[model samples]
Target: MEPLVVAMLLLLLARGHSALGLGGRNMWLIKEKVLQAREQRARDHVRGGQRWSSAALGSAQHLEPQEEFFPQPLDHFNRQNNATYKQRYWVNTKLWEPQGGPVFLYIGGEGALTTYSVLAGEHVDLARKYRALLVAVEHRYYGASINPDGLNHRNLHFLSSQQALADLAMMHAFISHRYNLSKLNKWICFGGSYPGSLSAWFRLKFPHLVHAAVASSAPVRAQLDFTAYNKVVSRSLSNPVVGGSPECRATVGAAFGAVDEMLARGESAALERDFRSCRPLDGSGDYGQLAGNLADVVMGIVQYNHELGIDATIAHLCRLMANTRLGAPYRRLVALNANYMERMSLNCTDNSYQRALEELRSEVVKPYGVGERQWYYQTCAEFGYYQTCEDEGCPLSRWLTLRSEVDVCAQVFGISASSVQGAVDFTNDYYGADRPKASRIIFVNGDIDPWHALSVLRNQSRSELALVINGTAHCANMNPPETGDPLSLQHARQIIEEQIGDWLSRRPLYPL
Candidate 1:
């Protein structure tokens, strides 16, 4: 038991917040002259619609964007026994507008830098219209960055949040030093969702390196109420507007319930076969019916509100589900059912505590409402992450008791809870609320986010804590139009950009 506990401890310690350890806790004051220079640069960039003034553009102007491919190794899941292979990554800088202003280091989430760069260009003033040169980079796990082979779970721990933080800090430093802007430049980091958490963590670990951060829809809390999000999905599915007849919800609920029973009995054979046998979502399952099935499930989770007509939604899924009739009611219903199925699968695989929590919800709280099955509960039991209630029937009261010992291996930071907590604690102590540091960290969460409303659970410095309820969304509002901006919810992109712009300008934040 001691050894097991020790191993767990070591694993946790080796986890995320690598940037904090690497960046160190140093209180560096910006020189008065540097402050004046940065202020001037900010004004100039905002006025000139560029990141910096013409005077700020130095030798970088003559130096074209360096387009070079750098091959790196990737070893996330593979253990260290086989031969190591190499993957490729490209590093380059464009002629950014914020030449003399603060540098915006945008590290993209889970895709090629180009993919994220497009999103950034749309939401942000890429011409350095308001701030500094935007330096975007790719995530290590995705794209060209890769680890070595034969690296098992233990070794891959290096790929945790700590390493990511260190990587971003290093990138910032590299650009600062290379561009000779280290003395003249200030750093502002921003990202959404996975990258949003990364942005928040970056400021926490590298306060000295960064001035402020804008984290949108960041999932900082490890244990969140994902089951609640699922409830939203069910509610939406049952709504009549989307063609969900009264029976639609019950039938779908029954199907999921069947799945739940199978999981409780430790039977995944049926699901595995169902997944394989499910028809294609489109008219045919050329890519395989399973592909369409997976899409329907995931789309429901993302809840992407497309202007595409209901017929299009129905037609697309029907094709994926291999249903020929574009107007078939059964196909439409099945498509919505696929949404619940896909989301449950994701919650089970991506979240560590999702499965056990769902089981508990079903046993305890579910009786009062609907005794429906969720994907997370079934997946958890099937994957051996947790067990179901037995003998005493529904042990709802004891459901919470099971969580204390449950070990969740799935984490975005690639670290354990304790180590991540330690990293956060270090940040709080060093650059906490009372600290008179020039930099201020702002954390934003959509009220609907599972991780929302967790300030009560954690000890947050109230002065340092800033929560923005974006009309019940999942992430932070980047560019908000005053407090009561009346743009459609789908137009969150504009709101996000405006808000971040305000932060960079050091303008007063309005409304609540």
Candidate 2:
């Protein structure tokens, strides 16, 4: 594999955050940043599960997982179309009891899955305790499950959260029948971020298929104008708990404000040189891409705040932005962006609109965007979690507006901006958004994770409990209990385990 692919693989292993289909990533760079994680599993095995330099922090423990595939129907909702596609999956029976064990199904999101996905992380730990059968199904249109008909508008019509949930239900039957699973063996589903939403939806849609669900940093609400996303990012940047301060957030806003001034002044040449843009920022779209990439650096740091792999923590970024010797706020942003690019092994940051369009418009999977294109289609059709900056207290440029983002929907998929709102409403109406009338689901979110703004933070009901960790970021509870973990995160995980135990034991989480 190329160094670029390897470098990108490291980011994908983070697992909780999204390269596409989330608030922070809705309008972010689609080119170099879209290194879909399909290849990470193979690379990790070659390097022996330790390719990630940071903590391997949340990686699974199972080694030598048995890989398999099931011929899943392409259009699960279409009863007539019997055309099936081979869906890749992995099973680890290391901890399963010979007599009977619970099935811990790891639902893949917008990307591929590695054996590490099935073997590692918090769910695997639970699987061990419960002696559960560990199985992971790659989401349709991602990794080896990409539909053979291609990603055209017509083919992608079948790709929706509704259909994906059906895929999960079908997989449950396939795996249960294959394992000879009986009613004694209950199913517990797990996922984070977009997959996290899937986990919640799976329980909501098919209560019989899954007994319980643990959704981490799951954005259950779908909205077109996700301005609240950056609003939360702004707050997180000011959170002193994670090394953020008023000055840090102020500096970010000032930096983007200065960049906007430069762009308005038509000083594209100097701006490109300062930010190390690979191409000239000639048009409005390229300029918007530049703004989006700069904002992406801050958004990613905040979303993955204090996570193991990301070297550039909020503290590191704030320190760079605070250095007065860096000159102005734009200069400080330049320094920070420089560090982020270097961390990702990127030589020159491409801020070309046409280049991004080429990636989004392509039918075949590109090396860079293995699933981003597919994810973009989903956002256009179903969920419009576009992280725009037009809202108040936004630290990024105003040019990264809902209009600019919805334009991608129009340009590539011909999805009108007006239609986007309808799709988002449909998603929320269908799944019940954050307040979905579902039982036996524990929705987990970290205060610092912007996606939390859309999750179930408060206790909606006893059965549908919400656990929000005070001093943590995206999917913090989903990682194994570490020494440096905050007390709140530790407690949150305990509550999750308790809930799972109750669900399995048939104990009512709430009394009537």
The C-alpha RMSD of each candidate to the native structure, in angstroms, is: 15.9, 8.7
Candidate 1, residue 226: the lDDT equals: 27
RMSD of 1: 15.9
Candidate 2: clashing pairs of residues: 60-119, 60-120, 61-119
Report the lDDT tens digits of candidate 1 across residue range 1-512: 12442343234335621100110000001112222332343344334534433443445353223333333233324447453323222232343443446666665553334322422232345324554665666655444454432123334334445456766766666667667774345677777655676777788777878877766665553332223333443444444443334344444444333433333333434444444332222211111122223323423222322112233232233233343352343344344444444523332211112332233343222111111122122122111112211112221111111222122322221334454345445533443322323235455654433334322222245324455553333432442222343344435444445555565666335631
State how far residue 55 of model 1 sits from its true place (Å). Answer: 18
Measured by C-alpha RMSD in angstroms, how accurate is candidate 2? 8.7
Candidate 1 ranges beyond 4 A from true positions: 1-95, 110-112, 115-123, 126-128, 224-252, 258-439, 442-486, 489-499, 506-512
lDDT (Cα, tens digit) per residue for candidate 2, span 1-512:
22443343234335532122212232243222322221342344324532322232234443457678888788876779987777779987777874657899999888767666675678877887788888998888887787656587777777788888888888888888888998778899999889999999999999978989999989999988888889999998898988889999999999888876665555789888988888787566676677777888888888876552445578788888899998998889998888877767777777877788887888884322337788888888888988887655798876666766777788889999889889999999988988898988999999988999999987778798988889788777766555677888888888888889888888445652
Report the poorest 10 consecutive residues by lDDT, candidate 2.
17-26
Going through the candidates in the order shown, the clash numbers are 47, 3
For all predicted structures, in order, the TM-scores are 0.51, 0.87
